[model samples]
Target: MKPRICYTVWFSQRNRSTLLCEGLTATGIAGKPAELLELPPATSLLDFYQVNDYAALQAKLWQQRMTENGVFGMKANAPRKESDPIIGQLAKLSGLKVAAPTPYAVWENAFPNGKHIFLTRRNKIRQAVSWWKAIVTGQWHLEKGGERKVDSQVISQHYNFEAIKHLLLEISLRESKIQAFLEEGNIVPLTVVYEDFVKQYQQSIRSVIDFLGITDTQYPIKEPHYERLADELSDQWVERFRIQLQKDWKNVIW
Candidate 1:
């Protein structure tokens, strides 16, 4: 049978879906649903620059997790770039003969029966500041052992109101687009709040397993091996951003 698909729509960069992904894969009932489309080293089935048969490529990807009752979980980051690269990749794969694709169209095409999970944060200000901090510090993620994914030399961090403002609006726009797409498609996704998921790690994971209808609930859940990157500086930025945002009368995004 074709593998059941679980598509996670990440609101922004720091949605902490890695923890959720870890919990799902630890069950061994869900196949690895990583970003095979991301650039750098291409996944085997998608040697996009050379491969000509788009149909066969899609077929190979679909068959990767096929099993009796296995679920394939994949996540897509926010569409903050100038163009939706996923759609671009798919268009190239299709030889550009058809109509240009929308984000939801590409998702639906990949997994016709895919179930969606919406990863969001209630505090948009904090979420935006968290993203800005990572950019300034050059530390994208932190490991539990205190290791950091950082640059060769640590960049001195600073608070830039414009940068945070741009990110805040981008996040707002992303949430709006995602909700509109799901509503248009009549899809109800499992909404996982970043704030709540971090606090109720096990419960959130169980909820996802339940959403996917996985029967392996008795297995022990796995927590994220990474640590929360937020600190006193992050909190300060959150407060500063909210205060600075007062000048803008279009406070709907805040």
Candidate 2:
């Protein structure tokens, strides 16, 4: 066996993972990544793959989508505790090979010998706001022809200080954890930041394709037709959060 090559994107919510995945899917080389609808037990995987044994289903799917060069890809953002049953299940699955989950190192061990992409955002405030907005709106993504309307009733156009604070803390911790994991792994991933990707999309796309060892001629790559969900309210919330962080949460380093 020429090594079951699978690329994994280690990311958290509201980090432009969807946008990146969409772009990659457009390239026709990378298999779109999957996310757990809720948490473990991810019984949904059975329906997603339409099989009882998710392990076997994933194996077959990987083999089917894998190129001659031995590359298949998916997105992962699961609990990283060694005791978590989800980790065990993922370990048994064909693609993810998480041997242990200590701190934020689960992803590192999962694909020890496989290519990984560390997708993130630099603006923690914006990231947190986006997450909260998504939770309230219940719209994680907007397709090209999809409706642009966001459900105001979800969050009620009101800024929940507690929600924003919690999200900010979560995003900060995850970002720090990911950094530590990357350093420990001693692997420099093809880092994609949300801000940078949008600024230099064409170059970014090419870089990801090259990293995947796929020839440009292999797929007709096209730019994704999507827009950022952040609006004026998002900006206002980010500003408010920043002020709050500076005032009462000054001791906390985000």
Candidate 3:
């Protein structure tokens, strides 16, 4: 049997994760189709399988596993605190190696033997501004299918302007930590910038393919359409946020 490649996308909300998964699926190397593996809301690890109906989830996993043409990748938001064992077990059962590019420390630790891909967005100011708008307008809550509530205080606590700056800083710090961990010569991970990933999707995918030791024909990269509404505050908003991002950038190694 060919080696099964298991991938997990580690990203905060609205980080172009869906597009990345599409790019991975387009490669058609591993026989696995990319799918989202979301955990059920308000479920603890003890009752995760019971609440999630593992039978259906396992069926999807089997379908992806049975693919004969290309690699299989899955996208998910940050795993719940309790679902770690489930992820680990699924990885073992499927013989899949994990891949994540987010800054979540838990997934990083969970897949210690797996490859880590750190993806950083180029325009932090824009990202923060977008996040801010999403929260105020309840766009963030809507994406989770309205099952999860978006607490303004929690948002303020976790993602306020200052908090966003720290989040960027945390991303930078994790990059360093991953590098240092690799320096011990355990796991060598790949890093990609979001700007480069968008502009050169094929190349980015190629890097991922090569890292996984897969040889496949190139796939045409499709550009995603993104439109910004005509708003007066974009420039000023970005300018205000840019100061913090610039400071964070100085600390970022790559």
Candidate 4:
């Protein structure tokens, strides 16, 4: 029997999805929505997921990530562009003859009949800074009770202004493209804001529960599983990025 997929939460970098997915899993009714089909680090899309194909992905999920209740949830980072590696990853593994590059098209076999959730961060510069920091440090998320420390080598000389700026553009462009995809598909996703969710986590989880329309009693809410990485250095980069933006462009920050 085919496993039922309840929804696919779409996002990009630095949206704090790890924490939110933890919260949602705690709810028990949402099932465990894990990034089961993600592209591996340091591997290009064309180079991976081809041999195993889509059946392998499902088998992997059923054996590991899928819940016993027959409710499955998944998450995917929105493609930065049509040419994004993720599209190729999905298309090849999908084992379907999907010509389009968007995830919705490639995962049509797995995506349809599932709801959509779009997560976004309100602060673009901060998100970009976080993305670049993680890329440089090779530490995307910190587990709960983990020390919020940046690598010593990274802070001294790894701060590249242009790299962060380029990431900011990538983040922004991908967001625009995702919005269009949702609009074109007439898909209304439950949009969650990172800052607001962090401020009122319990309430935010409740909102997600309500969106899922589940009547089961939720498990006791607990402290978030992941810690935020934003620090003084993060702030410093944000301000520096803004200053550079002002110096290079006109009326951008006013």
Best by lDDT: 4
For candidate 3, write residues 22-117 as lDDT tens digits.
666655563333434554765533354343544444554535533464344554443333345445544433223446323233333332324545
Q: How far is 56's C-alpha from truth in model 4 (Å)?
A: 6.2
Candidate 4: where are CA atoms >4 Å away?
1-5, 40-64, 80-106, 151-157, 248-252
Q: Where does candidate 3 stray beyond 4 Å?
A: 1-3, 30-37, 44-66, 76-114, 138-185, 218-220, 225-232, 242-254
Backbone clashes for every candidate come to 0, 1, 7, 0
Residue-wise lDDT of candidate 4 within 188-242, one digit each (tens)? 9999999998999999888877787666664667788887888878888888878
Global lDDT of each candidate: 0.69, 0.67, 0.50, 0.73
Tens digits of lDDT, candidate 1, 70-149: 56666666554547555556554442334866666666766656787888988888888889888887776787888656
Better of 1 and 4 by TM-score: 4
Worst 10 residues of 2 by lDDT: 103-112
In Å, residue 63's CA in model 1 sits off its true spot by 5.1
By lDDT, highest first, what's the ranking? 4, 1, 2, 3
Could you give the candidate ranking by TM-score, starting with the highest?
A: 4, 1, 2, 3
If both were scored by lDDT, which would come out higher, candidate 3 or candidate 4? 4
Clashing pairs in 3: 29-70, 29-71, 30-70, 30-71, 31-69, 31-70, 31-71
User: Which of the predicted structures, 3 or 4, would earn the higher TM-score when compared with the native?
Assistant: 4
Residue 138 lDDT, candidate 1, scale 0-100: 77
TM-score for each of the candidates: 0.79, 0.77, 0.56, 0.80
State the lDDT of candidate 2 residue by residue for 12-107, as single tens digits. Answer: 888878777767766666655555323445455456656788555555556544555556676766345436555555455444434454533544
What's model 2's overall lDDT? Answer: 0.67
